[model samples]
Target: MVRIDLKEKEAGTGTDLDSVLAKQRAAFNAHTNPPWSERKANLQKLGKAIEEHAEEFQKAISEDFGNRAYEETTIAELLVIKGGISHALKHTKHWMRARRAPTALQYKPASNRIIPQPLGVIGIISPWNYPLQLAVMPLIGALGAGNRAMIKPSEYTPRLSDLLKRVLGTIFTEDEVYVATGGVKVASAFSALPFDHMIFTGSTSVGKIVAAAAAKNLVPCTLELGGKSPTIIDESANMDTAVARIANGKLLNAGQTCVAPDYVLMPAEKINSFSDAIIEKAESFYPTFAGNKDYTSIIADSHYARLQDLLEDAENKGARIRVAGDDDKQQLAKERRVPLTVVTETTPDMKIMQEEIFGPLLPVVASETLEDSMQYVQSHERPLALYWFGEDKSKREKVLTETISGGVSINETAWHVVQEDIPFGGVGPSGMGAYHGEHGFETFSHMKGVFTQSRFSQGKNLFPPYTDKTRKMLGLMKKIL
Candidate 1:
């Protein structure tokens, strides 16, 4: 067995990324296939650590976000991760077990089975939006697959990143599960490592960079990239219910969610009513922007400024800006908060229409018909999540079959990601692969198919030089297969 003292890894500098990856690779090679008992224990320890430091994590994340609500942190980050851990612990045994597979009639007495084995060291690059969940959710999948992991969290959330490095180090050694902390340089260095598999959760632009970096090493990647997720309001939908649900999903984390509805496409006639209801719903959810604990602040000043720029460009392009919640100018500036602002009368030429609005800015686009809305969605890049609100079964099916996205939440928003049974990921430009629950286990594992042959097997008949007997066998195979 090979080993390296990781005491000097406390700094997690960009310069040491290669050495750290080497150390983790050595540890993973030593235990290529850990038993279910050991994997379960690691998961348990991680869950315990999370539970023990839940409060600290909440506080640290809030400090990073300049006032991320306590409940928001608990619901979106802590609880989601804990739920994933519990789900993984419950199902990992079955996921790890080798399952019997059927053999062909010509190969009777021979049997087949698939053995799921852990990949070597996994590299995880998590985003700043939901720091703890993005970082630990993939970690759960890696550990469950019996793979060692190295995480590089976003630098935007320094407090959470430092806390993650410190807290995770307490339960696992650096070689077992290391946390590399730094800015873009360290992140770039981390992505360039030759790991068995890499998982990155961030924007499409950055995901492209990470994918390119991993491609240089020929490392497979599971990118959870973000795009402009769209929401469709059907003609038959209840305006109140649709608006309320969209509002909740959009305003959560102050609309920093990757799957948040970037824009809404509804019937042209109903746009006014829908916009009114959404504004009212936003106000009801967050009566005031400042001093509102429920309303999460933008993660950083730069992001806040970018959101303002998006709104400004839209307004300059003849879009109407509706401030939903009461604006507290002093508090907004002090805490870097952007109120729930809705942009209507938007055109494709607007900057807000082009980029992923990872903020509290929602653009409501008007569509003449359901077909028109679907056409609009199809014309653009596929999004991470597509939402449709309606009771019409046919229309819902049309949207489902016609549109392609990472996931779909009918009559709802952002709920598809929390279901552990479903594989959560993006499609095309949005993302490439998926991970969650068993899907995650499969992603981190190499499913090796093993075939056992018996002495009486007939497969040997087809492996010889051309002969009358071989021709007869070939004729039989053609008939059966």
Candidate 2:
């Protein structure tokens, strides 16, 4: 009974989501959910399909976002997909095995175990920043946990979503996995659906709305939202390594990544050296970013406008702007690309310092003491990720223990997400719930407890009416048990 809903082609053609949900529910009710072995096989099949269509996926991503680098896309998006599949295949058997539990003495001759069961149909809403990886990663977990899934990719990256649908449709039946494509209306309707579980990856604001919608049906959610993630550089830190790593993380995808170093904290004396090194690194990497075809890209006009607004506001507030390449605003604006600009003498009141600047602008905040820097970060919203660039173990440990974030890295940036064995998620305003490896598989599953008892009877004396002896015996049994 499921059909494609193509009404109003201009609005973006979305599948009949109601029918899709109905079909999934029917499948769930009929106990047709894929077994653990079948789930593993399907995941491996999907991973193989991604590998076969790697070129097409890369091309679609580049076309959608203007200049996504092939190698970067492969490492960030495709490799993560492959890693998820590999992790699932390796751990599916173990994950599906029933876990035994200790039984109390009172329950003699009885055994107990916890069983991991599927949570029926799961809905995944992905963002455009890292569309392919974010969309497929959650699906891998749901599949590994033996659940059907429906994915709704961001409308901003329409071509990539279409390409994903075409590629995935070949490997998976609609009843097993479905990809729904459309604009905001479709996204809203999709969110409102009564899924057993949902995972949404996007801005914190939109994540709130998604959570609200999911709340209506009491659907548990895993929200991957963004916040102003910070990178702390102490005086004892390696200046060269810190600058290089920060520059690389910030400039990737033109600073579109959620975990990209939003700003840096450094001692007053080290500010000049750090800023100089950052500029040098930027030139070596981009050379001529405004005209360079090798460098990646910005999302679109509106995003560029927003970044520009942040820069203009910062500039007007007496902050010195240092451009890595050209300072010609008109030329940069015309190309819809802005050079990596570092803002110094920034205050907490500025818009750039207040909001999560999802762009190429990097603000360098100077701290007189390490305590001041830690306190500064503590005052702000807990970030999705935190990076520390110091060789001193004590200093690093202090920051790690005192400050709170979704995840943290020492001496590097943004590499923690690739580890399939570790959990990746956020806290507070950043997000809620963890997903990536086995943690992701567990998120989409309901752990049910099972117990079996022997037929032997040991309580025949309890059938007698209340008496002095019986009461004393019952009291003694209760105490011993």
Candidate 3:
């Protein structure tokens, strides 16, 4: 069961949104501007808190996800969060440093520089899939960029949210980092609030709603939405290595990851071998997923049902279902457990082929040629991530250069998201804007341009005198310099 703690209500109404916003507004007004050193200190302290609670954070995620592997959680959530913080700490000083710019000829004796400043208070709505990492990492960015924050963690992972609230309470005052916990109603209220900036991580459908609500206030937002990400296995790829990497990535968090390989595209002749290899590798990783403790988890009962429904629908439409583990109904139905399912001979009209299967289901489509596979991906919405496995450098470069995705990986899956140096985000339907490393700090910051000039009159001759001499002088200046 999930436990919630809401602030006491006022007479004749629920908790007051006006009061909460007042507190935030007051805080923002008091600290209208802050120095770079203070922002760096706060960010460093937050990073220390995260490191101190690393074990607790990992355990909370494990409990929430039922059978989440400790190592996987550490790699996927903990390490990613740590890496984001560490990267921010290392480069924030440089990121915050004012950048000098050339003064325009019209503005003589003036010096210009771009200063990255905070956007006051930022609101973050994190999804349940990666509650700990997603929630805290963005906050790190906001704080690093010198902004106050309010976070709304998904109610689906209520336990983790409670833990986060407690942890944050120890390290920060409510004015520094506040947490609001409730169901969808609270989420709606939170999104509707006029935050200086907002960051949302969830499905594209829900993202649309958040975007629409944010539009009311003309609030800037960084949305990280999900889509049907594709993995292409070229003919020159190492079959064994490709299969292992795909299986490892797909089964992590039971495929509840945003960047997990949603579907695979390969030559028609290699489909059978690839499918067999994936099943073999999956069994090797978890001898019995129903009883195996190494494999991670599913979100909840409803999600399990939804995954089953998608599979059933595909099966009813003549798609072949291949199970990597035991297919016993009783075992599968236990709690939120579902075996890794591989679908083949899929048509474009099938629901599974068209939708993002946020479960341990892998869809394999055979294409007549590499171009056919590329065309399939091109036809769909731009994905948050894309993957390719092949030995031919030329072919790999061609795929990478030709395609447009939020991020890409070569010969592996889901590893690009962990590269702290590169920016992580989506484009078009997948998502908008990015946040991680310097990109993250910039997202939460406003680059204000400042110009300083000496009070010297150097262009007195060009003061509104519409003569041929003046025009000729202006033309000469423009052409020469």
Best by lDDT: 1
The Cα RMSD in angstroms, rounded to one decimal, for candidate 3 relative to the true structure is 2.6
> For every model in order, what is the number of clashing pairs?
0, 0, 0
lDDT of 1 at 275: 77
Candidate 1 TM-score, C-alpha based? 0.96
Clashing pairs in 3: none
Residue-level lDDT of model 1, residues 1-481, one tens digit each, is: 1122233345466668888888888887887899999999999999999999999999999888878888998999888998999999999999999999998877679899999999989999999999999999999999999999999988888778889999999999989999988776678789999999999999999988999999999999999998999999887888788888999999999999999999999766777777788888888887888878878888877788898899889999999999876676777878888877889999999999999999889899989898999999999999999999999999999999999999999999999999999999999999988999999999999999999989887767777676888899889877888
Better of 1 and 2 by lDDT: 1
Point to the candidate with the largest TM-score: 1
- Estimate candidate 2's alpha-carbon lDDT, on a 0 to 1 scale: 0.86
Tell me the tens digit of each residue's lDDT in model 2 across 279-323: 989989888876566666677788888888898898899888888
With candidate 2 superimposed using the best TM-score fit, by how many Å does residue 474's alpha carbon deviate from the native?
8.3
Q: Can you give the TM-score per candidate against the true fold? A: 0.96, 0.92, 0.94
| Candidate 1 vs candidate 3, lDDT winner | 1
Pairwise TM-score winner, candidates 2 and 3: 3
**Model 1, C-alpha of 317: deviation from truth (Å):** 1.1
